[model samples]
Target chain A: MASTTLQGLPASPGIAVGRCWTVDRRRLRTPRRKVTEQEVETELDRLDVAIDLSVQQLDGVRAKFQASDGAEHLAIIDVHRAMLRDPSLVDEVRRLVRVERVNVEWAVKRAVRKIKGAFDADDEFFRERRSDVDYVGERIVKNLMGQGSDAAEMPPPGSIVVARDLSPADTALFFHDRRVAALVTDAGGVTSHTAIVARALEIPAVVGTGKASTSAERGDWLVVDGSHGLVVLNPSAAERAEYEAARVRQMEREAELTRLKDLPAETVDGVRLRMVGNIEFGEEVPGLLSHGGEGVGLYRTEFLFMGRSELPTEEDHYRDYRALLDAMGGRPVTVRTFDLGGDKLPSGQKDHSENPALGLRAVRYCLRHPDLFYAQLRAAVRAAAHGNLRIMFPMVSGVAEVRAAKWALAEAFEQVVAQGLPARMPPVGVMVELPSAAVVADRIAREVDFLSIGTNDLIQYAIGVDRQNMDVAYLYRPLHLAVLRMLKSVAEAARAAGISVSMCGEMAGEPLYTLVLLGLGLDELSMNGPSIPEVKRVIRGASAREGRELLDRILDLNTADDIEREVRAEMARRFPGLLEGGARVGPVSG
Target chain B: MGRLERSFVIVNSLGLHARPAAMVVQASNRFRCEIQFEKDGLQINAKSIMGVLTLAAARGASVLVICEGDDAEQAMAAIGKVFESGFGER
Candidate 1:
């Protein structure tokens, strides 16, 4: 057979070379037939028995997985269990059987379609729910037809499992034991339950391959390059050897990253920097800690305000912050207050401003809606009692905004104290994201406990380029002379103010810019968990003196291209085999 | 027999999504009561997850929960606690 290469979405990062284990999960066919009046009662009985059996099977699956590590995927099973007993579905099926005089399996199929119609909206969340409803319906139909539960067959260890589509249950069953070397599916996006489970299990997976299930047969040799979302079938011996070598290299890189986890992000010349993770939820804490995150530098609070119509209540804010603080276990967790009204706003609110990026957002939005802002502030102060919680206001354009935000925090602190609730005045900081804030960082630094440079926004605002615009994306260079100048000035201003300075941005995580950030005298660097070890490794090897000299050289450069080329060349010379891999480590933007 | 009705704002971040809907249904099923939910004039049986989900009551949307039966008071109290707890989510 000719070698066939399929491009797909990279669902998990790894590579596997093994024979395919094709899972032939054909869609269950629901036999549709009219039932006689005498058979109607029997059909209803059959429906009840089928629903009970389906619930029992889900319970069994849930019980089996409850004891396993990484049990986050088990929540899906609980939802499925609840859905099986849902009166809306069960009632609909019974009504269909009695009124339409159809067989139990046919009634279940129609009932599922009816229930799915409610979730037919073009929303990602609803789309996932629709799939859930379908799976539940399929399970009942299969049961009514006397087909056993859709438990997956155990594939031989080290086989790459290929499927047209696997329900969450099927994916859970296949990948539960961690024996499957890799997985390739014809259908499923990065957000699909299958993709999410595969990632949680850290298995090599390439999803949305379009035809991987049909193209590869059972026992066919396959190379699954999950990192690049490439699958090679019936590979030549040369290609197989090349992939095998790449797999080993990737394993070595992972091992090396794990080894660097416990080390501090300190320069060879004795300049120490705190390495932290930027996170949104408590669920990410374990992953962050595993990667040696000392603390959370940017705990974005905007997610609480998203996807919902109403503003999060004070209790909502309090619970979330308390959980995050407790998860960090006395390590500082910087919480950015709701940075809404620009691109992100609560549901039912629309941004009518022609240029929202420069419009009412962050501090401006908070100031305008004191009620909303107070709820979060009160929550922040109350949560500060539990652990080390630092409150930072985002998109502060000037010192006045910083002062106003501080006043609000003080009021919240007083209110909490007057009410006799546990509260503490968390250290407040300003996010120097706007160009205006960066320009007057000295003044803003004086009014805050610390300063965190949000380079993604600063770069966009300073360079006057919307990175999302394809034509202008190339101009969104982190090493632009203007961005470097702003960063240097901010670092100098924080030094002058006698306050700590940190950067929680894409630039902080990029290994290519590790030396440049070190040169800027940042006290902390916060990024995604996976990027922490690599950046720390880069920092541990380089000296602060060399970093300063590199910064000085780049500052003299004329353009972004010149600065990037100089930095790239310096990194290659200083750390051999660093810039060769073109892997993007963390998110390029928030 | 008791009849109780109360308005609740869906405060959870994800709104009355799948998990919350299940919670509502499970709570409604625990008592001998006829529970109905009304949102934007659309009334649905709170005992049905599908009915609760179809409401799609986003955060800030007001949902009127009505319980009527011999155990209406107990059912209302149980369901109210679930709503106030935000279904164990943000």
Candidate 2:
């Protein structure tokens, strides 16, 4: 066998080395037409029944998860319900079958396209996971008009889950059966349910593997290494052995991490570091807490933007946030007001610039959509009373944004009080993601109770290295002195303002950079839920004094190159592969 | 064809996500037949549990029902309604 690689947004959990089972969602067939007037009524009734069945189908899937997750999966299901209930669908079906006399499949397709057009124009997050909704809608419209059921045979669980894209319905089948590992799909974003679940399952998934199966046969040996997001087909014996060893090493490292699952973060030097996690959704709650996260450090509220056909309403935000807070008990959960823009914005946003990283997002989107923003603020305020909740604004670079967000938050608190809902003042914080924010962080820190140096964005914004571009992705380094300098400034500013500061970015998770960050006099460190234990253990090994000493040395370095060399030397002497894959930094900034 | 009676359980932990529900619905719609799901002695027209679930099918329970109509016999065979009854489901 030979070796090759395919890259895609990683999603979902578990690993499998099986034959590919691709579900071609695009090859959807519509319902049929009637030959007689008598048939027209019968067909309409049949179409209605079919559509009803399809809608009910979604309801059933939603019901399945309702026990474990109450009404969470209903976002997309509700949208399908809307499609089923849409009066226009009946009109369109009649027009196609009765007027155009097109086959049921064709008619259904046209009707679905018309409906999809509305959802497409809806918003950014909805645009991401709408295909699942559309697929369901297509099935309903087709059946209503008399198109027979389109059923794709699921390959055995031992088979690799291959698809153009997968919906949560497709993922649910793998609840306990772990054989379906390593998903390969032709389509999806990193945030897609399929992709998210893949990563959660720890499966080696290579999505956007466009026509990957064309490269080999069903029986031919292939290696799907989802960690590096690679797929090596027909590898030489040497390459196979090499990968086999690498896989074993990977598994051992994972096992080691799992051992720290219950251990508290205590340094040998008797320092206890705050080890928090990033929670994007409630499903992440168990995993995050299971990994020993003290609590949620950064909850990207932009997640509401994913799935379904419409924007999440105030009640939706309240319910979702409330549920998460309830799950966390007393653990502090920092809710980052949507930090979207760049490629992450809902596709519906207008005139989206190429450099969206430097464009309007987070507070900007909130400010523009005041009603939705205020509703979310109220939700957070209410949820705060349930647990140790903190409200944070993303993409803040100026004093005005902080003041404005705070003002809105105050109003939200007042409204919640008026509504007689339990409320608490969520500690207000800002993500120091932009250079402007970091540079003037001291003054900004004065306005807020806390600051989180988002070194991923800070480093990218400072060095002007696009972390995503593979060509320059190599240039994305964390230990760069400028970034350290910025961190120093934010830390100093927060200290001056008497406000605590934390970091919830990729760099915060790196053991080598941990000392440098601590050295800078940071108060808290939040990282990937999985890294919390070891990073905390590393912190325990060093006193705040030792970290401060390391910080002092790292601060004096002038170049990114020097910063990288010193970190590699120190960390190599300490731990290997600690700073390996983590962009030496985090997200590429402006 | 005589209406043949048979049962299938919903093996999936979640009885019917929208897609699967729709799949079962579509499957039932294909045969010139009538399908109903029965659980706890309460018969639910397989067509609508948007009623039966107001009855609540707990994860582990026995549910029995069958298909009736022109092609009810064939529809009863492939439909996994029996699986939904939690037949040995973990």
Candidate 3:
């Protein structure tokens, strides 16, 4: 067979080479024979047995994952279990079986279609639920047809599972043992249940690859480059060897990073920088600490307010912060107040402004809603007494917002004290994200104990380009001359005020910009847990003087492209093959 | 002795998604009462996950919850707490 390659959506980040094992999910044929009145009871009994089996199977899946970190994905299985016994669906199926006098299989098919009709909205969430209904219906129907037994043999370890699409149940059953090396599906976007579970399990997966299931046969040799969303079928010898080498290198790199888990992120010279993690959930604390995270730089508290009907109360805030502090075991945890508004408004609050990003959000939104802000402020001060805690305000425009936020914190502190509650004023800081904030960083620094530059928004606002908009996305460069200048100035201002400055942004994690950031004199780099080792590796190899020289050289560059090229060339010359795999693409272009 | 009625605003973002819908159904099934959710003039049995899901309530949407039977008050109280907590999500 000729070698062929298929491009797909990168659902997970890794590469795997293995023989393909195709999961056959052909649509079952429903026997639709009319039944006599006396036969209706028998049909109803069959439906009951099927629902019981389906629920049992889902429970099995849930029990298998209960001890693992895939707790979030387990909720989907529970939902499926509830749907299995849902009165609306069960009653509808039973009605068709009794009144329509049809076979249980056909009745299930009809009931499923009826249920799907109720979910025929154009919304993505509904679309997902519609598929869930279909999967549940199929499970019961399959059982009724005497096909509920465990049929397909498990694929051997390190086999790539290819399928047209996988139900959440199917994904849970097959991937539970962690035997399958990779996954490929002809359908599903990044947000699909299969994609989400694949990422959580850290399995290499390529999804939305049209015709992958049809093209690849069982036991066919395949290479799944999930990082690049490329799959090679019947790869030529050279192609196979290339991917195999890449896979080996990736594993080796991971092993090396794991070995650096205990090492400090200090340059060859004596200068040292704190490597921390920016996390939303306390559940992620163990993973962060394992990757050598010294502390929590940005504990995004806004997530506590998301997905719920009512605002989180002060006790809710206090409990969460205290737990996070205890998890860190006295390591600094900087909790940012609710940065609501714009795209992240709470339930029941709608943003009616013409331009939301530039409108009331972050500090502005919190100030306007003092009651909500005070709850968080009071929680932060109370949690400070338990462990190392710091409080930071986001999107501060300048000194006035800083002063206002500090005042609110003071009020909350006084109130807590008046109530005879445990409270301590945590060290405070402001996020220098807005251009106006960056311009007056000196004054803002004077009002706060430290400064953290949120480069993601700063670059977006400074460049005046929405990174999600493809046409303007190319202009969203981290090494842009303007962005670099702002960073340099912010760092200088923090230093002049005799305060520490950290960066908690996408740029802080990228190995390509480590030296430049080090040269800017950043005291800390807070990123996702996985990125800590690689960035720290770069920091450990280079000297601060060298970084300073590189920064000076890039500052003279005339364009973003030029600066990026210089940085890329410099990293390659220093680190050797560090930029070759995973998130990093190919070599720099002219 | 009589039916109980209450109005609620779906407060959770991603209003009444599958998890929350299941929560409402489970809570409603705890009492011996006929509970229904009415939104946009479409009423659905609160004890039925599918019926509750059919409401497709988005955040800020107003829903009229109706409970009636011998245990209507107990059923209303139990289901009201679920709605008030936003299904304990977010």
Q: Which candidate has the top score in lDDT?
A: 3
What tens digits encode model 3's per-residue C-alpha lDDT throughout A1-590? Answer: 77888999999878888999999998888888999999989889888899998899887777767456465577788678888988778888889878888888998899889988888658677788888888899899889888876556899999999999998878877888899999999987877788889988999899999999999999999989888788889987777888788788778877878888888899999789999999998768988998999999999987778766678778778878887888898899999888879866987678888899998899999999988899899989999978899999999998888999999999999999999988899999999899999999988888899999999999999999999999989999989899999999999999999999999999999998999998999999999998899899999999999999999999998999889999999999999877876434321111
What's the lDDT of the predicted structure labeled candidate 2?
0.66
Per-residue lDDT of candidate 1, residues A229-294 (tens digit)? 889999888778878887877788778878888888788899999999999877789889999999
Query: What's the DockQ of model 3?
Result: 0.39
Chain B TM, every candidate: 0.97, 0.63, 0.96
Residue A68 displacement in candidate 1 (angstroms): 4.4
The candidates score, on chain A by TM-score, as follows: 0.87, 0.62, 0.83
- CAPRI-wise, candidate 2 is incorrect
Q: Is the docking of candidate 1 incorrect, acceptable, medium or high quality?
A: medium
Query: What DockQ number belongs to candidate 2?
Result: 0.02
Query: Where's the lowest-lDDT run of ten residues in candidate 1 chain B?
Result: B10-19
lDDT of 3 by residue, B30-64 (tens): 88889989999999888877788778887657799
Question: Of the true contacts between chains A and B, what fraction does model 1 have?
Answer: 0.52
Any idea what lDDT model 3 has? 0.87
DockQ by candidate, in order: 0.53, 0.02, 0.39
Name every residue pair that clashes in candidate 3. A306-B90, A309-B11, A309-B12
